[model samples]
Target chain A: MSFHDREFKKPDFNRISDVIWEVPTSFKQGMRVPAQVFTTKKLLGEMDAHVFDQITNVATLPGIVRAAMCMPDGHSGYGFPIGGVAAMDIENGGVISPGGIGFDINCGMRLLRTDLTWKDVEPKLKQLVNLLYDRVPAGVGSAAFDDAAGFAKLSHGQFREMISSGAEWCVEKGYGWKEDLAVTEEEGNAEGADESRVSDKAVKRGLGQVGTLGSGNHYLEIQVVKKENIFDEEYAKKLGIFPGQVVVMFHCGSRGFGHQVATDYLQLFLSVMESKYGIKILDRELACAPFTSKEGQDYFAAMKCGINFSFANRQMIAHRIREAFAQIFGKDAEALGMRQIYDVAHNTAKLEEYEVDGKKKKLLIHRKGATRSLGPGNPNIPKAYRDIGQPVIIGGSMETGSYLLVGTKGAEEQTFGSTAHGAGRTMSRTRAIREIVGNTRDMPRDKARAIERRKVEELVINPMIKKGIYVKSVSYSGLAEEAGFAYKDIDEVIDATAKADISKPVVRLIPVGNVKG
Target chain B: MTMSYHFVEDVSLADVAFEASGKDLKELFESAGLAVTNTMVRNLASVHTKVTKTVDVEGSDVENLMFNFLQEFVFLKDAERLLFGKIKIDEISEIACKATLYGEKLDSKRHDLSVDVKAITYHMFRVERTREGWQAFVVLDV
Candidate 1:
């Protein structure tokens, strides 16, 4: 049978609330707990069938606490749904799975607050975007592109140190401001990262890609915060967001290095999982080892390196962005008030303390394509905005706007401090391409695919331009695949999160210019 | 059928998936390798062969071998900044495979590139001997 023909148990969801749905353990034989999904009824219906099967499969894993939860943006991913969040009891036979994280470890969102408004930026927007595009390497084949040589040049030893210390090393190298680390998750440095656990192949792959923004839905956008979009004036002011303020938001991660690290451990775990641990998973991508085992500990150490590498990667890119803005505005970045509001990672497995059954417990929380939404008063949050809560940046498509949100107490009590990441894909890339270029098979190989380019420019790019959003992309075909219509409505997703009380929406920032990978 | 590979639709929500078939294991590996390169480049024929490199990989089984073989190209694209126009299998087996890859270092001005594939994921990844020949299914995380 083909892949789609493979049998998967359909979940019979019981409505726990208007937004919360549960699939009891009886739905799957191996399930250790029920599976839960947080989404509106309409969005839950729109979710792919594979999401139910995948999240239920996650519930079967060892030491899964409470339930295997999927956020509103959940979609069918390899082992867990993309917006999947699961916590494991480490004192038990809890396991660490690379699939639970992702190939691009710590792939995340970063927002920089600038004092300039749209009025100040509109005239120089094109010049600024082109310069930023030139400074930051993006899209496929960027590692080999000669232009990127001017962006970041690090020696082997220095590269190693950067991965070990994350953005701290970058600040020391004068890549960013000292205050920037305070708003970054984990202070932009993950503890227990051992470089020895990373392979030479991984190091080589990651060395040149440090500051580059690799492709596939990764982007850097210049957004404007209109006054009407800001929900809470006090919170917005606290976060340095003002009416008509121009900001820079980018989403990226550790490039090839993280992929290689995850690939290495996934293969290693597959070799020993069934043989050594006697753990049988529903999918090979869910290959895992017990938390306390040598293999698990080694993978965790290596994974931290991936996390740190991404932190440093974003830092360097932020530095470049600051430089570009400084050059364009004819002022220092600090003088332009380019202070970073926050940087939050979505793809990660963090060990955090949460209350369970009125007792404080430390659990290894695996958030793949899910953000950590720490509630107000949580000590983990930065002191400056601790009363407002941890900042959650949810990136939408280039055509639609992105959002600034804050964590809520409801998230801590209900979902283990997790929320949706973005407006998840409702359409495949092939489908998106077909909508633009028609069937590839029907056209001759040497036709130059001029029609494809024209269609993308007309259907995707032109529409965004009509909306006054300037876009610069490396490939028209790549741009077409990321058209806003391919994703679920961002407004609906934010509403779901708000209704669930997991995250409180602060403001919606519309893109004025975008550099898509 | 003369066509060796085709992109599979609807199998993955956000990534690319494809199927390839060949009369033998050598041809199977070649067809799959070409599919990988095709996924990244708008037109496979546009890539002119200039540089040749030999790649060798080993795995526990046929499926793992296919995964490792394809991952080598991804590694090359990132580490060495090479993109392949063509792939020829020098040797193949259930556990190990060796191949010669022909392509030039990436030139942004000359080549029309698409998404950067992160890795070859094991999700729904399969390789099997069919009635006609050998067939393999692969999902690429872009």
Candidate 2:
């Protein structure tokens, strides 16, 4: 058995509120602050023990402000738990760590709104899905779409421009509309992206992947807002989301380009961490350098390139999606009212000013598998959404429904304006494979694998089809690993966030069709 | 006979995890490489040996060497769109490893793909010398 296989006991928590649990600094040594978990009693019990260990470790990091926090969907991960949040004071001796911000930088969610309803899309759902599946490449090592439809081939100069400009480059190239950027976080182009800071290897890996949807829980889905599921009708209407209306939501991040950037920086930081800055970490994954150090600034600039790359990636996918719809319905996407609602990144480290100890301070906030939820009246939000707050997209398992939520002021006060990213995994992928396919140890290797494939069809595909949800996947075995049973209840996770007032639910969108990567 | 690799349970909730054991460092590197490749493609046999790539990487220790070695396959997948079904480790020491990877350019039609292994993560990543041989534990960000 491996060291990770060791069972950990849940820690005793002090009740802060119904949805808030706190672990004092006394619970662990070398702690600078307490750890807060925004989850219900039931979810707390279901959380992995490593979450407690990891979050406490996060609290021990230098110059951490207030408390290290985990969203309701928090789960144990390397270094920091997934759905973890930490704010490092820049003026102080704070540090920036790549582990805190996942490898897939800005791996986020995007939603497009359409005026068409279920009645309009139901008839051609399968055709639309198949076209989407073809137009947008999915799964492992997926290259860009055909040259005619994709910007897969680019000169070195052009690649640098795209990485620096992000979705802004797409809009200028006619791949997206100008209005789409307004609703997007950072208007689809994060500030301070320096092409020189990014490595040639990262560029090579990201060059051809602009329009691709990579594998592993990443997907593009057609969903509908059922009339009854609309929670705040006023906010939904403000966001241009109508009951029964169809929308397209997809999740991905800076593909290999981002991975390489994180890897390169982690290696560099690890080399200089002890001798250059004398920072010690409980886990090697928590490698870091002083926020003001040359290494930290370099990584930040390079990371922004990854953030911009994802914005471009999702923007290109949105273009292909619009084309697919237009080809299917024989009407241009504009006439069909294909407008973007919002695009939000769940993994990132951004420098923002927040009131700390009653003084406004600039802090580099790292959100790993957590979404930024800015409340109303924030200047960072677009003009159209300033009064309503940022739109927070929380995707659930494909079988379960996803949600459209709005940021609340409570999030700013309690969580540094952060919220849960998704219905966090409750079971491992291997566990899902075995539990769904049943025992096949006696069967031959190929035969056992075949049974697993068949079980995915019979148990996952067939049932989904019966319920009128059309699915197109590159691999059935990959789809089996994402079975709905492998995740926590989305509704429960949403309830926890709402009760905590970190985010307010707007609409619950059920999947009508899916293109799984 | 020693097992080359086996999927581990109860480690990571979202990503894939596996433990690979070999009688020596060379075998250990081979088994670990296969584990990384196998996580992406369901059947290595489906990826025909149409291409061969020579891999050379160095690290400070066994753990770092293993990390760098496994990353080669991940980098190949993204940089060249290549998949290696077979790994032949010619040399492996505490500080370095040299290997040959044999596979083909990914053809979605022929390859039974599973998930894109985004990167080899250091979370719970370990490599150690055991009583009989060398064993490594790896968790991949899929």
Candidate 3:
């Protein structure tokens, strides 16, 4: 049956609290565990029914522990909804699925703070945005660097090293500061990356697209923090966040390299899922293999390579942003205090030790469209922020504001220490395009183009300009698809997480400029 | 018979979904390829058939065959920067197929690129024969 025809009843959910809901294993025939969703009643009511279907599908997967969980910002995705999290027991026939980690292997976000205030950047905001647009190669099929010579300098050997070493490779190559690696997740390097297992095609795609901000929801924003928006004054001050402070936040993934890896593995897993592993799944997109099998290990090793590629990718972008700042401010990046607060991967499956049934067991945790929210006093967090917790960067739409949250111990107990990544989409891209741009399905090509151009100006461009935000994009239609109205309210999404006690808000940021691909 | 394809809205929050139809296996593959290309660029006529690449893919079933066939185009677009607006199936079978893709290198000035499709997803992906023809539903991660 088509997914749209699927209907869910309110009785399917067993309310655990005001913000938490559960779909018991008895709700579905094949489910091995319950599905827990962290969201308010209003958000839950507004969520698409497919989200529940997909998450319930995840609960039925083999070797799932506790429950298949969805964060506050959960929305429908392929096999598992975005913002879905599940942990599998490695010792008990646990399986690894590429869909759980998403196509973009290490799709993530990074936030860099600066000492400058909005006053210092307000006058040059236009020039700064233009310069950044020129320096960073963005848009469809964008390459590594703007200059031909710079792109050519990246040789095959260097590319291999970069994937193996991740952000450290960037630092070694003098692309970023040495201290930058410390604040990154896993020191910006995930171990057990076997580059030999990576297909040649994936490597070729990785070579030229290391430093690009690819299109469709990926962006870089310049933001300001107002004193009233600081919810936790002591914690914000400790993180060097002050009133009127300017920060740079960018969201992207491992680019085509990660996509190719996921593509290759999904194909391979489809063959092994039923034939070799004797595993049955509700959907082909949830294709997987036993973690101990050769196919699974090979995919894990190659996935590590993809993860490293993303780390290196963001590191290079951070370096370029620093360069743009230096050019605009007439000072070195260090002197401008462009310090990286943290870099976290939202799409990944990491092997971690979590308490399960009063025993500390190592589980393979898959977090898609979710961020690692390690609470205060967690030894995994960086030394500088151990007392405060890991910083979770939630990138809202260009028009709406973003949030900076900290992990909580409650998250560790409930969600294996994970939180929502961003304000999930409330509508589909097709709906957004049809709402903003005239419906072009029946119109002639030229007429449709004219209508789209006019509608884009009236809908996306004008609204953003009125909000005092400068946007530089390669495709107007693409920008229109990501308009603020397309996503759920960031404030509401953040509040859900806070009410659920998964994360605590620290500061809110107002956007001043945005660069989209 | 001429290949036919049209975009269809699905429930994905971060993807573009569509359905393609054809009279037979060959036309089905061709229509699916065009659907993916059209998702990337607005106008299919603007992409001239200046270049050709022979694509050979093997799958154990019709669904796998369709998945591999469409994914080859995404790889070509990203790796070679080529966008194919037309396809000719040289041969086809349940387990394997070969085709020649006709398109040109992507030129930003000429092609009005719309969205960057990252990969073809297997979520609710299907290829089936109907009373009149064959059909497939595909979701693209953008």
Candidate 4:
């Protein structure tokens, strides 16, 4: 039967039972193949139709294999929705677009589990939040601290080390430990990043941004793990998540450097997209080139720079968080038992071997705001985590809880082993401000105006302004876009996901405090 | 047409929008261009015209349509010191726009603004019809 009966934007289809929907090639014009979505009817209703458009766009890209996939938290983005995933045949005509990678670049999230539980932090939530805010710079132009330290405003000749070493570079630079890389995605690095392709401006942005929790979707959150956190806790502990324990979670990426990189390439891609390949684009943001094309190869190389820069950036932030804890507790970082659980990036086009037509072939997979949830026993996963699969850290807003999930056995065939990034934006930022000021009263208007002013200033503004990165998106309901109340209850979303058997949930993280920027 | 933007600080802050209608698209676009420039420099009178350039922008949609057109003007002002004093829209297509903006080279000492508008941003951008005709809203890069 056709999807017409569904009565949705792109009528939802069936892929893997009812949990997954495949938008077959016949569903849309210029669709090279089907676009698969991992969402139920209830969750699908809440998603943005723009996400489907992005998925369809990915499907039409050269060298794409299997299908363009969207996780449960799918939302609109520049070229690819935040929770979109697609793999391409590298040898064929796999293409790469910086927009597909996103502006933050490797803005991934990491979760750290400590021995202390919420019982340890319930009364001290205010103290801990105040302490965290004071220690970690939130909001814009926060890297003044980077300059305070001996680190140069910008680094050189070390960008490559960041690519290969990932978190290790920060560790070597005295920002972190060598062991941290083990808990990071791809050891906190994507291999084959060519730094020479990166522009000097991008490098400048990366220099001070490392170790700084930049403004927007970039936040440090305190979450309490729940028992029925969504799926299971024993599996959560295997992923280093525990019930009632305190965990530090945040998401950011290669900041200005990454944005500039994407910006530079977007402009460059537009010039070459038509002349070199004769490609016509529906959206300027969707500009892309074949992976083998000189322009495409150059962009991939540059994007890897962004990925590596992000790995280093998160590593530095982790180090700073550890420092804050040590300072407050008057104990060594090791004594506090702040150990790296896992860090996973939600963006990038990686060359991986996946089954296409039931045969494994190397494909360039572009995952924007979609975490790579490799199934169990994958060699890429560490020996410790190989049995449980890689840890997927899903960050939700301060109001809605975050989740820790493990890859399911069937995820490989379903989504190339991928999962959602966070609670997809439920409304636009402009709408959020306007909704909060429904009456346009002087009080809320003043606050909104302040936020707007601070945001434009690019200074150490309010943490909420930083939410601009994960700007809320909605259609009919404007109030739902205002705050956490707008997002699907993270707990309920997790339940639907687990019940649907997309990924087995582990730890439920109820946020107590937040530091946005 | 003349335009003015006043950011009054009541409890906090807000960019109060104000515009004057014009006879043509050139005047309309020029007034909007001045609104953006006003955010930076104290006045545009100091930045004289050493050179001028024509910018053509294309977008199938009306929103991008106005955004790209304004951006080129902003780009010339920032990068080339071409402050647009007058504008003349030759043709406006469904997706493309052709315009002639008159301005001269930039002098940092003269057009001394606190935040340098590096480029125009695509964030929270809009363009719509007004009682007079069409209007565009944009945030300048600083």
Error of 3 at A230 (Å): 1.0
Tell me the tens digit of each residue's lDDT in model 2 across A371-440.
9999999999888888988899999999998999999899999999999999999988888878888765
In terms of lDDT, the poorest run of 10 residues in model 3 chain A is: A2-11
Please list the Cα RMSD from the true structure of every candidate, rounded to 1 decimal place.
1.5, 1.4, 1.7, 8.8
Top-lDDT candidate index: 2
True contacts kept of 3: 0.59
Which lDDT value does model 1 have at A325? Answer: 98
Clashing pairs in 2: none
Off by over 4 Å in 3: A1-11, A146-149
Ranking by DockQ: 1, 2, 3, 4
lDDT of 1 by residue, A360-414 (tens): 8889999999999999999999999999999999999889999999999999988
Task: Assess candidate 1 and give its TM-score to the true structure.
Answer: 0.98
As for lDDT, the candidate ahead, 1 or 3, is 1
Local distance difference test, candidate 2: 0.91
Error (Å) of candidate 3 at residue B17 is 0.7
Per DockQ, the best of the predicted structures is 1
The lowest-lDDT stretch of 10 consecutive residues in candidate 1 chain A is: A144-153
What lDDT does the true structure give each of the candidates?
0.90, 0.91, 0.89, 0.64
Interface DockQ per candidate: 0.75, 0.72, 0.66, 0.08
Q: TM per model?
A: 0.98, 0.98, 0.97, 0.76
- Across A1-517, the per-residue lDDT of candidate 4 in tens digits comes to 3111123266557656566777888767777778888877778777767677778877787777778888887766655666788887878877787757776678789887677787876766666677676566544334524436666444466654575456767788788877788888878766777777877655654555556665435678876776665466557657666666788887777766666677678778877898888877555667889889999888888887788888888887788788777766678788877888888898777877878787889878788878887878888888888888778888876556687887765676677777777877665533443444332222443454344444333321223335322211111111122256445556555655666555677767776667664
Candidate 2 DockQ, CA atoms:
0.72
